[model samples]
Target: MEITPIPAPQIDLLLYHIQHHPAVLDDKTKHLITTMFQKMQDITNHGDDERRELWIPADRGTIEDFGDFEEYLTEGEVSSRDEFEELWLSEYPDSIKWYKLTTTIYENTCYVFLDNKLIFEVRPVLQNNDTKDHSELAEWLLSAVDNCLTALEKGEYNAFVADNLPYSKRIGKILREDFWRIFPEEKAAYLKDITPDEMNRFFNLIQTQPPDSPAKRLPEMTHRLFLDSCRLGYAANHYAGTNTLSSMELYRSHADGRDDGLLDINEDSPEDFAAWYHDERMRSGHPWEVCRGGNSTHISLYARCDNRGWWFTLAGSSYSRSVETVKFYLALNDHGIPAFLCDGQELAAMLAGKDYIGIVPGEVIPSYCGHLFPDENIIDFMHLPYDHTGAIIEAVTWHPLDRVTFS
Candidate 1:
């Protein structure tokens, strides 16, 4: 399949934002992306099947026809492999937030070939380099690569390679052999190396500290460890406005203690998890003042963890909800609990024994939460309607009394 490469400015922007920010891509988008890469690997290994064997049909069909699944795949559109690739290349940045980065590598350098035919070559690049980094800018460029590689290594690409394509093995092997061919080891220290102070600075940022002096260092250590966990989960998406997780609060009110509740759900909603998460089920935009949703919905609290976490779910309605939307709040709350009400009992079962997971991004230091800050954006991403900067402040404002910790 013929593929149209990503634009130069777009590649640079993504690379820039990730090095400096954290948690930019939401879970759904991440899932979609990993699936897309998986499809890419499958095609690279087995070649186009003509039998419609691709996995991530959403992205491919979305691009070719710009509609839902039935419309795109049912017709003759799938017959044109080139059209499919072009569609994938075009829609990729939008789904995966590609406009945020501007750097590009030509396809030939990344893929491995056999039998003189194209096996895989790291999807062709339509645009090469729009922004150039000299000796002075070298350090920042290396840092950006480091962050990008980390994100990709732990993310969808890792799983896709393991499960599907043998040609697409470790990204490190590709990098050491081909990606860094332009620079020798000494000259590429900026790419291959990092400093001690940089290491300590990174550790200091993600740690959280205790309110009391004795427990302070412990918090910091935990925060650092949580960040490590995120990296391991391949959830380490860095970009502007990611560290805002410290300020999320339940939509509670004082005085009358009201919060415009609006939702209701019993055991008999649709099997899909939507009834519980969306605003439409309540038939109102505002949530009730007392409960999470309308009084109609009453989810039984299943389990409370020693890790300052809880799980409860109601099934009724779902509208205007994206994984990013829920993540938007989670990233804002410092000690926020990761909630997956839509998954129903299965998610609850997973949570049954997994209580020790700590709050992420910030490490618990002696008396303070140690958070690592990203470098300034080498590129920019689109901002949402709400004041994201304001959201950061709102997320971090926690009271000492409200502070809950788990050992």
Candidate 2:
């Protein structure tokens, strides 16, 4: 059905009264009212035949109850009799006796009343079949704001995080620090003012890049590198006082074992046992176990390059205990191995125009090469976790003999 338009002067007076009312209406509600007013004006300029009859209260010797009519209405449903009386008095203070004021809009039709007397009737034109159900749209728009506010108040950080919403970290900090009151109201106003078109754009951005997309995957890949770096640092510190062998010395020790009949091996064997020992130690157990005074599953292989001189290979673990552990290692940088956690932008800045090697995840092999190249002078030994793992990974990049940070 088409809309039944109301006059512009009437709409102006209604808006003035509502805006000046004692009870402050939120920005979302105000915008909704303004939009309805604009739509009504649009319909009046382009007339239609849809005429809606005014609401007539039933006469039963008692006052008509607006609460009973809520099912038939949509927006602006009268909440309580006291609230109605208060609003009515604010708009018509000169009246001797208080009159019940009820207002609501359903589809294109708006109903306004003074007690049992119908005062105004308005209907705004609906654009198309998509907006035929304006009640649902209006309700959704209001509830979206309400839900976000509630989540912020209740310290439900994951609610915002899971949706991948913008400014989630700031929202969490606001909740944790109880500093919501310090923030400007415009932040909330912006969320309330978000249009359907804008929301659709956000969803489109998310849809175009699937969960496994590189843009989404890079942060996680970097995060694993970060945790591994931390664990590597911890292991290096734990073994500081113990006697450790250089990569060549470790290999010679194993070769001597074979020569002295300590180990069964063919004399013609040409195996780098040191590298094998390092890999075996790295894969033995969870990395965080080192923090608990448990045996570390990490090994350091010292090697000397012609240009870079002497450096050690610190293998990171694929597991960690908590962020607290990371913080502990970060604060205690005396372990000789430095690891830092950086965001995407910082990592990009560090690697810009620099030669670096990327280690691709085993699964993506030839197809998905996420932010890494196989052949580069600066080796990025950081491991990339599988995309489907659902682990929260941060970004990390490493350069030999230079400070490396990961999150």
Candidate 3:
């Protein structure tokens, strides 16, 4: 992936504006993000993969907005971009918003990954006027850049450009027509006509999904650790736009970049756990097809007879109705995937009375767990949706094991 051609003039214009009238800035430090950002681009390739990845870095603390010196510098500076991102986030942790744009090349396709942090920060400052409206120049600057990038995603690359190019040219037009008339000379002078250009550069691609990564090749311990995590079960994906907890949120409290992701699963593969956390079912099983073309994968339990079992239904409490929880159920139901959903009632019972045994992510030895059902009653997973996403399913169903022996 190639990316470049940032009009140097726009940089110069923003620098001049922030420097001339620094008083317009406020404690909403996130608001005055325009002039105080760093833009680092790279081109990278995945080994043996056909696709090359382009990386755009946002939240650079030391920005070269001024020709004389860099601004937005932070104390206790970190060495690498990854470290810097981590350090900046250490103080104010928030999930970064990432956007993906798909571009087709006749028979093939390419994707443009844009994280909002990498694009531009939010500008919430208002201008001094009767209406005290937002600065159109600022708004147009970011939006026009976005429009141009998105336009580049649609059709014939060149034809698309012919019609959609000059993204900044349009921004310049907007600035001249809208912003220049409102602000005083100090501020208005900085809102110059945007310059448009085309350039190219490469960046290292991010490991977007871990399951497909080479790191997925695991040894006994890593594999066991993965199973342990799965057995612990998740509390649904905390998909509040920025949450990454679906990768075994049950074990890790919150996934911060500081600690090694692999450690969360107690794996020592030197590969990040996030990579192997495919969120796919982890089990040896037989798929049982049911009505409506739906099916359920049953767990392999030695000495356990294969019997057509009743469906053990699970209704997500009002709390579990989140998009992530529903997604989890649908994903498990997909193509009859295998997964063990423990309500922890059994674990809690065993912990209280030593009645059952199971593998937990944190345990060194097989331990007893609470019994979710008594009186020889067992719940079996009968059938689930094959392709459920956003489907309003009433409950998540499960299948019970004939008997469990822990190792």
Candidate 4:
């Protein structure tokens, strides 16, 4: 008797049930189930015929069409097509039954059946969800940072290397190769207890100064300062930090000798020169234009407030939602602060609270009118949009609790 093919939707539902069933499967069985489930999901979501064909078995009219079919048989034990079918059915009754029932409708559906029962039903186990809570996530963040701090203090380069956190690799190598040369005990002390005001002051100081500008009697400490800034930002607290490129470096490198219509450092004031250069680079639509070069950490600080922040660091020129960013947001969420990965419009709306209603670029403008808007586009300003800038822009925001809201 001919068998009707199982519907694709029914097959998908079966796979989903097996995948999520509470069962203690051996590694091989578990991997097979997971992989097949993922492939099914991918095919369904993307509608890729090529990918579906790769996993789905094709019809074989004759035994010769099944390549290497003889390998599954004992030596000198050749059989006819009918004999082979009988042998396969006898040997793997459950699998063959499933395959015949489905008739090549789904990928790897037979593997999920063994001994006349579904694998999940045959070897069921208790399900234990291992999701971490907010306090636990917060502890993880603190532990990771504290371990790095302890490593720095103890001059243990291996500790940094062994750490799986995002900042550990570069920080480890630096400490390993040039511990005494660059990061002395005094310099290492800068990474602790960094506040938002201190970070702002550091940025203001570095804006016009050369790359070698001294802060707190240290020469060429820009990189160290940036590291210190990140140490606090990574904690996901009230503190804010940025990895801004030096305006002085831009002036010295790009503006000094170029005959191109770029802003001239000589003719314009430092403020105008910086503003014009930033705007020109931003308009060029290349993030690397502003992201790269001397003393620039290439870490984009997207947004920050009293309880939350959004930032990401690039791996070379390519943007990545790094492991550190994930950990940061996770920690923030666990601590009851709403952390999100969103575009500028969503970010603006979130900041504006539940009642915010205005056109993004034209209707809403930044409350603070500053010349150098670091990550600002026409749609949304990266900084806080306060009420004094304009009425449309003004709304209840996520600043400090004591700060008055403009009605």
Query: What lDDT does each candidate get?
Result: 0.26, 0.30, 0.26, 0.29
lDDT (Cα, tens digit) per residue for candidate 1, span 1-407? 11123333343343444443222133333333333333333222322222111111011224423433445557866546566556556545333221111221233333221111222223333233324222222233233333334434455433432343211111111111221233245224422232344334323322332221211112111222322222221122232333443211221210013222311232233322232334354434332121233332322111112233322221221111212222222332223333223322222211121111111211112111112112211111111112333333232321121111111
**Pick by TM-score: 2 or 3, better one:** 3
lDDT of 2 by residue, 1-407 (tens): 11112222233334345432222124434455344433333221211332211111111111222123343234465566666556444433331212222344557565443333344344354323331222322332233333433443464523323333111111110110111123335235423433455344433332343232122111111222333333344443342322465322333332112212212332223233223323444443332222332222222222212232222222222112212232333332344332222222212212221222243322223222323333432222223333422221222232221111111
Model 1 vs. true fold: TM: 0.15
lDDT of 2: 0.30
Native RMSD of candidate 4 (Å): 26.4
Q: What is the Å distance of residue 403 in model 1 from its true position? A: 50
For candidate 4, lDDT tens digit of each residue in 349-384?
222221121122222233322222223322213222
TM-scores of the candidates in the order shown: 0.15, 0.17, 0.17, 0.17
What is the alpha-carbon RMSD of candidate 3 to the true structure? Answer: 28.1
lDDT score, candidate 1: 0.26
**Could you give candidate 3's per-residue lDDT for residues 1-407 as a string of tens digits?**
12223333333344345442423333333332332221101112333322222212112122232121212234435555566555545532322211221111112222222321122223344334333222432443334334433433542233533332211111111111122223236223322211111000000111121222112222222423442333222322332322343443433332222222333454455234334433344222221110011122211111111133112122221111212223343333342333322332322222122222221111111112113223422222111122331121222121221111111
Candidate 3: residue 257 Cα off by (Å):
33
Q: Where does candidate 2 stray beyond 4 Å?
A: 1-230, 233-328, 341-407
Worst 10 residues of 3 by lDDT: 197-206
Model 1, residue 16: C-alpha shift (Å): 14
- Listed per candidate, the RMSD to the true structure in angstroms reads 24.3, 24.9, 28.1, 26.4
